[model samples]
Target: MRPPGGFPIVCHCLLLETPRGLCLVDTGFGIGEAAFGALPGYYRPLIRPVLSDAEAAHAQVTALGYDPRDVRDIVVTHLDADHAGGLRDFPWARVHLHAREHAAATRPATSADKGRYRAKQWAHGVDWMTYDDRGGETLFGLSAIRPLCGLPDLALVPLAGHSRGHSGVAVDTGSGWLLHAGDAYWFHGEVASPPHCPRTLALTQRMIATDHRERLENLARLRELPAEVRVFSAHDPRELDLAVS
Candidate 1:
């Protein structure tokens, strides 16, 4: 969703320092044009991502005085081109995601799925760790898959709607919990007491959503989350600014 004054649409990815190793919540546009290579022609004009090699997760990890290889696991919110683009940068990392998402992206039963999910991102044949909605605990009234592949502090909260199996990655930051609400909502005001979203942004969300009704339902649930649990979306720059501050 385009913001007023032509503000850039940011792709916020979370890099966590875990006991096992470094874990990435989602990988924004990968090195160079690797992420855009498989995308359709029309995508360029619509999204207009600012491509920069320095901003790639690999480069950022290296800049932080850590080897890129240390990132052993990647938990993705969905298989969308922008989200999963950096998987190739950390080919050895075990990619964790929802089973339904795996099917939709890999198999691609529908036209929308075909357009959104790009195969080149995972062309290296990643070590995939997929989960489902069956038997799991709940977090703030939302179904959650905890102890993600034995990582106690991390959990996957199923918040499908944007994609067939989109989810929010919940990180227990010791001080508190932070939920990376990936594309669940674009604007910061979406989770406000009386949730508000721009008409254009709302239209974009609806146009992109696989199930608009389910998206709204999950969004309502997000609004009810306790104040203690910090929640932020993938594309909201204000949230990102607050996070960095």
Candidate 2:
């Protein structure tokens, strides 16, 4: 959906029946806190999502007729609040993440980016399964592959740039491959055929990206991917049409 100022409001997550049972690529958000209204501190929320509350996340999982507990593993692209907020809802699941992100989030230096990592916001301290370089071969000439914590087919493709350990989780869905590009390219148009990226998208990425050069390199490689390879970012409005099942 288009938000004010022509921006698209998008949140993406994936639930897959992997070789190791049900899994989630990212958990979008959590319940609203009236306390957020009262916290008059220096911490600034970088981006305010269109989702005022996280009930949508719960409803989405439940609507699929799967218990939140049944959603066994969670592969986090990073630790941004929007991506990790809903983590509190599922403690039984083992959370998979990049090693760098785990380090960055656990110990923050500034308030500007601190609020984005809300692991404490979850009732259960996130159970972590941090990974190093583990994925498949190469895609579009970039090494966007990493084995996911022994889960054969699922791989953790490190394309870090949006954050310290930003990675994309690739699910080989038999027919073809689907990559949860995360913030690597916030919108499809950025990597679309006849490639284009909005001024705002470029500007925003430059401002927040930890390593702009690396991010751009990965992005260029992502573009070379076959059109059949489904690549969806976290904030792309088109994500709603993609099924988690």
Candidate 3:
């Protein structure tokens, strides 16, 4: 969806204030200079990642009046460069992802796979937690990771399609359930009842999807989520801003 000004999507990440410690769901383009140079030259122009000092997760944590070091866990939907760039900033945090995603990122077998992940960002040597469980509790019609380690109210809904192990981080936000559907669908309209998206955006989504057919199936299920369970995507600025406010 286009904002009033233009088509700048939000690179929104979640900062969960939990009793144990801070848990982040997906890390935006991290801090420091743009990693566009690290990306495959052909895709650079397409991705056009814009990194800012203040957008760093560490800086954002400090702004929230918490020690950046206090961020002890990172629950990732996938290890795409844009989503995991900030992992370098939180070396002490235990990074978690679906087992398949971890495998794909760590040992990329194909040229396309290698191009999709940036190894430089994870060079910090993270304490990774990869989940291979086939069973978990069900939430909003999807089976979710049960007992997400220390975060009880949070669960990982495996929505693999865009990536081999793409997932949605579901949280009980006191008000109701908030499902962060990370990259399963980019635009909100993809999950709209009728299922629509700008032709350009839709094309981009399909081209990048690891399993295009499965991605569409997942989106159909996402649209059926109960009204009380708030669902949003990583790049939808309107939905992201509304959730923040």
Candidate 4:
């Protein structure tokens, strides 16, 4: 489906300079994937990614003057190909994600799950540390799995709907909490009081959603979050611009 005119989507990832080592929240597409077309065939023609090696997370980490090996932990909101494609690039990093997400990607009980996840992205056998919502603290009335893999002030807030076991990574950035709402919503307006998403983008989200009703419910809850808690979507360029600026 064609996107709206002049409305660009982006793959936004967060790089954290933590006490232990560099921590990455959502690794975008990998350099090798871009060069060798590791992504599914339908993705290229539909998404039309820029496919720049420099845009890859590994390259960006290197450009920032840090050794790629220093990236010790990776927190993924989900195991979608675009989100986890950089796993091989940082082979040594411990990957942390929801247990259900890992199972969905690796086992793929449903056809949709099979299509949504790419095995080659994680075929190298990563050191995965999975968490469930059973035992965790609460954040703003939402259940959160905290201290992901022993990293302090980091939590995974379950916000499944776009995909089974999809979640938002919550980071305590010293100043306040910033929630990276991965694929939970596509546009900033989605969490507005009177939520408004572009028709094309809204349709796209609905088409890919594992549970459209639940997704909308989560979006509603996000809108009710306190103003101090910053929330942003994964693919909205406007949100990315606001974040960087």
What is the Cα-based lDDT of residue 6 in candidate 1?
63
List residue ranges in candidate 4 displaced over 4 A.
1-6
Instruction: Give the range of the ten consecutive residues with the poorest summed lDDT in model 4.
Output: 1-10
Better TM-score candidate (1, 2): 1
Model 2 pairs in collision: 134-146, 134-147, 135-145, 135-146, 135-147
| Candidate number with the higher lDDT (2 or 4) | 4
How many clashes in candidate 1? 0
For model 2, what is the alpha-carbon lDDT of residue 81?
Answer: 67
Give the CA lDDT, 0 to 100, for residue 117 in model 1: 80
Best-fitting candidate, scored by lDDT = 4
Ranking by TM-score: 4, 1, 3, 2
In candidate 4, what are the lDDT values of residues 47-98, reduced to their tens digit?
7777777889999999989899999999999988778888889999999999
lDDT score at residue 68, model 1, on the 0-100 scale: 92
Q: List, residue by residue over 102-164, the lDDT tens digit for candidate 2.
A: 888887766745755664655467678987764447754556555666576777788888888
Task: Estimate, for each residue in 1-245, the C-alpha lDDT of model 3 and write its tens digit.
Answer: 23223456766799998888999999876777464344456544555555677877889989989998889999999998778888988999998888889999999988878889888889879898877757677787987886677788888888988999898999998989989999988788888868888877787788899999999888888988989998889998878878778
Candidate ordering by lDDT (highest first): 4, 1, 3, 2
The alpha-carbon lDDT assigned to residue 12 of candidate 3 equals 74
C-alpha root-mean-square deviation, candidate 3: 2.5
In order, the Cα lDDT scores of the candidates are 0.87, 0.73, 0.83, 0.88
Runs in model 1 lying further than 4 Å from the true structure:
1-7, 34-36
